[model samples]
Target: MTDVVVPATGYVIISASPDFSCPDSRRYYRDKGIMQGKTVIYGDIISAEERRAMKKGFAGKLANLVWRRDKTLFAPDESCAAVFVDLDDPRFANPEFLVSLATAGEQVRVIGKSDRNDIQDTIKVSKLGVAEVLTSEQCLTRLHDLLNEVEEIATASEHRDTRYTIDALIGSSPQIKEIRKTIRLLAEVDFPSALILGETGSGKSLVSRILHNTGLRGKHNLVEVNCSAIPDELFESELFGHVKGAFTDAKNEKTGLFEFAQEGTLFLDEVGNLSPSAQAKLLKVLEDKKLRKVGSVEEKDISVRVVAATNVDLHEAIRAGQFREDLYFRLNLLTIEIPPLRQRPEDIRDLIEYYLNQFAVLYNKGTIRFSENAIEDMTAYAWPGNIRELCNVVERAVLLTHRDEITAKDIRSALKRGRITAAERRQLTIELPPQGVSLEDVQAQVIKRVLDMFNWNKTEAARYLQISRPRLRRIIQAAGLEQNRRRP
Candidate 1:
């Protein structure tokens, strides 16, 4: 006999075989009264053919199935949210077939009738991915508890996945769809190394965390290291550890990042900035999967998956002899290039809404809304700093705006006070005096104007002009306008 509950519809019982009787099972659920006022079909009144037809009829409507192993027959084509199996029955003795029935996203519970060594059998069955194991004495209460817990978890998981997962990436653009697909595919694979390349603030770090948190190594530690931030002299020691008395500061034997992330993941941020010596050491470790402490002759084997991210182009650095080609190849086994914000403007509105909601809850404030004009301006603006800049803008607007609705003026003020580039602030317009103007003269004039605007501060001027200070200096020199400095 099989008892099924079609969630939100009603409960029903179908007896599949007349020869196999389960009066105790029927009486147990009937006394519980959970299935009162539900439909019941008797196998004695219906033929075997009629039972098969009924099973096929209710296939799509069923949400969960609870079967008595001795009396119930297996319906290979039927599937449900959860399945309960009587482990004491000889017909359901094959653990492999029971596991196969569980499948992905489906729950299976094994119930034992005897107390003899059932705990050991439960442990063995759990290894095959059975969700829960219980004795028949505790079966009713445990089953009810398990169902409630599973329902709550399923609801929360759905909500969380919609908010923070790759699905929450929030874009309908082709580039974003491709990224989502790539992330899904990569999550399924067991690749050891992956490289994430993008501009600063383009969510490379977010991607790294998602990959580790959702992948097989999710349960283990995920160690992150900023290669550009570490000093060149301490790079090897910091990454590979050192023995006690290995150097002046080496008073204790230290565990390196590799050992810390053993059987897990190690994320190297800004990996393209590693020094030549550090790169060689990293390459050796990647090649051999082993490392030695600074003063120790013993080499320890590591089983760490590497995830490297860089805003700088490693290929260009390699061409300039600033990054190692071999290390690049090793880390670049699987590459995911994130498109800049400007390339996916359709996602800007969704991102703005998401951050607004996030910050509203974080700051314990009421819900905030954005004016149409504000959304228009934000969507049209070129976010050179990408999602990071947008988040800052939203945070500042939320904190500073007095009204619940943010207008374009609020966005503009936030941008101006934050980091508005000259291109975003003012459009340069040049009108020739009926006579053609020298391109160099125009360039020199613009450069002088920017320098004077920032009080002759080359660093600030370069930032406003969206160029490096060295590049700004070269432009000033080429234009022969070095003497046009404003005294502070």
Candidate 2:
């Protein structure tokens, strides 16, 4: 007899015997509230073809399947959660079939008719990875325990899968490795505030997220605020939200960033950009751990970890009397400095490969690669704008390149064209080889020299050379002088 129960609002009971008995089993399950209702199927009345079809239809729907001396009714697949095998069944003697039934992530139980020791010995010798071995009398209790255990394991695994860890920050350089270790250690502690300092495109925001997601407060909300972007007039209202009718335009009560991040983390990016008044107000909140809504008398207590990031030099700002020294000290309890892309050139190849594979999939372009010379040029260039610049360069190259492999010329063109800014130009000085350069080489050098003189400011460079920006780009592309444009 095999009993398969598909858990829904009710239980579906499929039985192979004509009588379709097991009053005790039904009553035990019902009393335990495992099933609200039951559906019984009599295999004796149903044809073998019908039986096979029924089993196939219910293969994935079954929550539990118990096979007792029945070989004709069992169907196991990846979706089956649990299966119980009776040793008394002649089919159970096939160890290979029993092993196949216990697929990965599925639990299998073997029950012996009378000898519990024999079942244990069989399980040990068979190396079946059976979850349990018991006599027929112990089946009910053991089965109940197994179900609970499986539920708990599933819940834990699901939670683990959703979390963000330091591994997500992809780089293998020593600096990055050390940063990962520090992040892991910081997550273990309950630090109130930490300061992350890095160049504009060096992933300070990513580190902040990793800190919040891996910490003790990971289950709570993580609110981020770009301090530099918020207008001075609205800064207070945005950070410490306003009550209805607080100001002329106030419409309804609003939750503040600090309050919204209660029991979690509040990431303040570009913290040095906060106005003096805003800085003082924020300092008071950090000291008191409370904030009153704009135009409200009542104050609410807040408990949130503060993680602040900045590309600015706060020490210089403090000396210039722009930033508050006390607030800086408070936020700098633990400081982490993210190294710029230029300083960690060794990781550039990995980063390029990573983003190439990523954007290839994103754009549905199959397997993109860079020429050896292109890789060499990329690694040699100073990524002044850091990872952001590299990302833009790679994205543009992937979009524009027609061939499977991005050439050196393609990379140079992308890097030079993408980074041009309207700025003062820098003069270039080049020395010709003793053997003397080719006419084409000299022309390339002269065009490159003029472009560099204009700081790759395409408009200014073209104006100085008396050509259009598009025409200048084409000329630079033709001469293979694009490499010189990114130097400054």
Candidate 3:
């Protein structure tokens, strides 16, 4: 895909589809600010086959941008196809691109010459970005809706002076004990530098806070920096402090985390995202026990204990050269591995009870307990998002329940966002000979499942598999499934 397979001079814009926004078409126009009255140029690159079908095979145009007028046919009026591209840089592909987690039905921009909305039909797409797709008008509407919802629900969990202890961490399982023991050991030994590794939404922050609150650093400041939330340019000032007049924006002298947490703990969350330059500075600070703030020539001694947490493996990051090897070594003086919620079913009940109390007090609502079936169903769920998802689900139930109890319907509402049938879910996994039927039967079933997934749209399904539509129909017929042959 990285190879430049597209022609730069002539590109075709033949669109109108039910399925996707081709990234090949928009790879060039990701940063196109706006197009109001701008003059634009277009071009045409036609295969000999399409050239022969001009006018005769054509469909009516709905608007300037193409439309999906028919189920399975496409044609151009007069010319083979007109491709729109910005005259400024005819190579339509933009350099910026977004990385997606790869989910079906998710919209993605593509770069190619076969079809398009604007100038991209010409110059090859060189860049693309996965980004917010909302127009300015839609964004304003959504903001309005959000504002209304905020007024309807005034959810503020006020802090209590209740004693915070490691015991509040919850769970008595072996897996839970391992995490507690690690924290206890870290606190007992007074480890200066450490890392906690866990998946997103896992309670790495809770563990770090528990460690600080119950340990020697309990009395001192416990400053936390979420590396994921920090701007790249301000990392130095944010972490190491800055002197007045350091830069245009540095209007006043500021004390940084290292200075503010002088005899305390500095919790670095999502430390995996730190820039290499930032990582180097952090390594120097850990090694020398001193930090030089941005715009400050003089270094100051710091007694901050670093506790970093990341969802990614630092060793892999080192191999990719996105992280500093020395910084990894220094921060990893001690490590705590927090297991995800899916792996600890024994603690779901405890978490349910714990969060129930939290929500009751936070929302100032009467105490609500989960029904037996609700608890069982929750524990049965895989919890791919871990504790954070659980907490959100519980909070939602506590707000909506009329009685002092939660029902399965509450959990169902949140989970039913994406509903797949038992058969549909079964189709995702191939069963082995222990229970499955003959190989031919399984093959036919899987083929039917995939075809259904594409909604009996043979051409679309074939494109998904990168195969010819005619060939796919032949296979379906060969399997004695002539009914599977797509109509229109």
Candidate 4:
């Protein structure tokens, strides 16, 4: 019997024989010794003519049935072991059918095509209670392979082990080595605060997590906040919370993140984005080791450690009167600066190997090996988006390219447009003439320059300009640049 473990309490046994189909029964011929589980959902149904062809020997046999079938035969209930349904199954189109499966089991997987419509349909079905959508290729292989790997990840996350160690910082470079050493030292002491500085996607958040999970307070919660995302008016309330009736919308007394993260770590991401008032308030809490809820006079003593991270230059921010100087000094006591992926080229290959194997298993594409030229091309390039960008490239290559070996062409196709150097950025800087210029002309020139810099890639241009893709497209069309360009 071909056994597949669902996230539920039992196994899903799929077979090729049509004799297993029973209109009135939910389970087929199940061998307890082989198909040992609380329940078993037979995963295929064939026509009456095919059912009549089943000989005595073929009647109860169970095996892999990877061929595309239009029907799934099973009645899911509280005792359902698993539900294996295809996207095109007529019954699958019903919301109640999916809901019943979801209510019975913890997981529902729909096997479908890898095309856009099917992918979008999978997303739509997820709202109706589908947990995961697997493409036919993913199902063809790694049915058993996925179980162990997925279980390992789930176990690690539930036990709080993944991404919470110095080893999570995957690199052999000296810079990464020094960061790990620093983290080990930080964990030995009860430091009040620490600072992490790096470019976007350079593992600053991972470093903060490691710093918290490896320390004495590892057992406690690690509350994270994106300082830039919080509104200026709600900054104080979000951090300190508020008592009931403190504001128009404060219907009930609420505990803030600081209190929730008691004796643990409060990770403040993009701290440099905090307003002057927010910065002053945060600095006070850091200095006093206590916090008073909004609209309250009583202060609660706190022992939580603060680990703040930012991609911007706080020194320059302070000089520009944007970030507070006092707050910077307070958090800069223990500092860790992560080198960009480009600076530490030694780690690129390691990262590539790690992500390749990871995504290969994740997508069920067995043993995808990158050609030497592919590795060389990726390693020599400057990864402007750092580790995050590299991951996206590798995942895309694994998901889209259907082959055992990946070539340099595949790597280059997945990688983003080349990042512009600081010198190049300066060289392309715009200047105003003595006669002055129209705002429209200046705007058009700026858009054109950014687009050209990224080799006319609209997505990259939009990101660099801090605008939406549609808006960028409109500007390009208005400037008549779209007519001249071949690619979107």
Best by TM-score: 4
TM-score, one value per model: 0.56, 0.57, 0.55, 0.59
* Tens digit of per-residue lDDT, candidate 4, span 1-488: 11123221111112111111232211422321112222222233333433332222132233322322333433343233334455455555577766655555433343332223353465456545553445443443333333333343323323444545778888899999999899988888989889999888788888887887788877565777777655566667768878988886566676777876787788899898888989999999999988999888899999988999998889899999999889999999899999888789999989989899877765567778888888887776556677887887887777668889988777666654434335434333355789998888789878876775575778988998999999999888888876654221
Model 3: residues with Cα > 4 Å off, grouped in runs:
1-163, 417-488
Q: What TM-score would candidate 2 get against the native?
A: 0.57
lDDT minimum window of 10 residues, candidate 1: 9-18
Model 3: lDDT to the true structure: 0.56
lDDT of each: 0.64, 0.64, 0.56, 0.64
Per-residue lDDT of candidate 2, residues 153-174 (tens digit): 3344233422247776878899
For model 1, residues 283-324, the per-residue Cα lDDT tens digits are 999999999988899999999899999888788999999998
If ranked by TM-score, best first, what sequence of candidates would result?
4, 2, 1, 3
Off by over 4 Å in 1: 1-164, 420-488
